[model samples]
Target chain A: MALRLTGYDEVMAQDLIQSTWITAVRRLESFEWKSTLKTWLIGILINVNREQIHKEQKKKETEQVREDTMISKSGTVSGYDIEQGLIQLPIGYRRVIILHDIEGYQHKEIGAILGIEEGTSKSQLFQARKALRNWLTDNSNEE
Target chain B: MKSKMNHEELTPEERAAFDELSNFKLPPASLEARVINELKNQGLIEKQKTMNIYLKWTASVAASVLIFFAGSYWGKQSIENSDIDPNLAYMLILHEDESFRPGDPMAMFEEYGNWMQDIIDRGIKITGHELDNEAVMVKASSETHFGEEATERTSGYFIVEAESREEALEIARKNPHVKYGGTIELKPYVVR
Candidate 1:
């Protein structure tokens, strides 16, 4: 059985689900039966999320220059132990890690969702795991 | 410690680590209720969009009706401000070729006359003719030919039934003679 979402994971998942509902409603007429309705709806939500993140990044660049300039790669911030680190990773890596680890989706399924090859999805997952493991190691050293 | 034993199988190692890491109990049960309520609020947005579209359509229909009556009122006012004579009609001379045709000056006039006949048939009385460019020269009448005051050159003429000079000029501009640097001089004719 899949684990229940909690903390920032639950919050972020909720945010994504809400945004997905709106996209589904907006594009309901174009829904062909080529793929499952959930997958089609989730695809639109992914694109929407990408656009929102891009706009947010642009806004952050202008208003909060410091926060946007250099990403905190060390990933040991006080509030963000692991949950925030998962969310804070760049979108490409986040998609890989979230699908494989948190969402319990197969690499092939992640590839289908992200429009990437299965091998590429596996590679991305490996990289994301390495980055997270490094962040976790660094976090434990501070303790 | 179990991670070492499970190192050969990356999946079990990662799963065990994730399970151990998320051991902390989740916060209050009210958070799920709050999220579900937020979802309901999001659904109401579509209803608001439909209402907006209906409001816009209502405004458009109202404006169209208002414009219909407003146009009729404007038309009546314009007609009241102007008068048209019965006998006087418009003349248009069109030269289609680079150089005017020899004796075909009456051809374009015939076309104009045919067009105006339809307007006349509709009870809006108007006649139109084409005048030859060479024939439009200031001509002396039989009596004036022998007079000392006979003029050799005069602008072309178009007779249109109008209450005033402005209205006459407005109608005269549509005449073919008004094109190609030709001037249209209007004169009121009394039909015996």
Candidate 2:
């Protein structure tokens, strides 16, 4: 449960939440009344995600090097319950959890965006949830 | 009989987990208002009408600049070549005189058409064909009738391409229509 507090917290949350606003503005024309406008905005965020991935790939290709792993120092903060251990899971599994659980995308929509079969999206989601639950259990035992 | 409780529903532990998960607040209200205002100002909503005017002016200025610079650049590149021969690649627009005759107008036109086909087939290189404003009005029959007489002095055009003006004239000499007594005018393309 990521909670709010101070300047550092605000800056970290900026990374997670900033793109939603820009996407809502850029894709105002494409908004249909099918789902909530927020969902449509999320659809645009998926496009932004694809663009970011493309830019990252281009950067990697140009540099011919892999980026370093990221770590946060405030691991034991009260709301930092995700068990920093879960961050070590493969990036694909992490992505599935973030897109599904945190971002609230459905399996079908996730499948469409990621260009995977719906069944594969479901399986990945299940595996990711199971892995996260296990990580939480293991960390709680340590605590 | 007493029934044993299964973990199908949230036990105390499950309830705590749910509460923890749902505790995170929605994004700040001020952030939402700021974002919506920014979106409105960005022309993503009601687009800026002034943009069309700005674009038109920009395009006109750009076109003018491009024309001036491109002409100067092209002139610089071609100056040496032009000195070697004043004409290289240029198009000529010619008006046909009203009174001129070939033996049979229709047959002569057919023969001229055949000549054009032969030139294409042989890959005798040329560029662009433009009918003069006056010549377009001159009937096909009139052109054929005029071709024999005026061809000795004038033609609808002398469209030629060569490394130099001299080469172009030499090429013109081989033209079936340019008779010994006929004239072919050479005009240089003056950059505007």
Best by TM-score: 1
Worst lDDT window (10 residues) for model 2 chain A? A58-67
For model 2, the superposed segments whose C-alpha errors exceed 4 Å read A1-9, A49-80, A83-91, A98-106, A113-115, A141-143, B1-19, B46-192
| Clash count of each predicted structure | 1, 0
Candidate 1 runs further than 4 Å off:
A1-16, A58-84, B1-13, B20-192
Query: What tens-digit string does per-residue lDDT give for candidate 2 at B42-120?
Result: 6532443433323222122222121212111111111112222224464443333333323222223234434444444
lDDT of 2 by residue, A1-143 (tens): 11111112453344324454455434433443344333443445444544654554521112211123222232221224442423534445555555555445677877765667888888876665565454544444332
What TM-score against the true fold does each predicted structure earn?
0.38, 0.37
Local distance difference test values of all predictions, in order: 0.42, 0.40
Cα error of candidate 2 at position B152, Å:
83
Error of 2 at B8 (Å): 15
lDDT digits (tens) for residues B56-146 of candidate 1? 2212222112111211111111111223464544332233333322222223323333333333344443323222223232546533222
What fraction of the real A-B contacts shows up in model 2?
Answer: 0.06
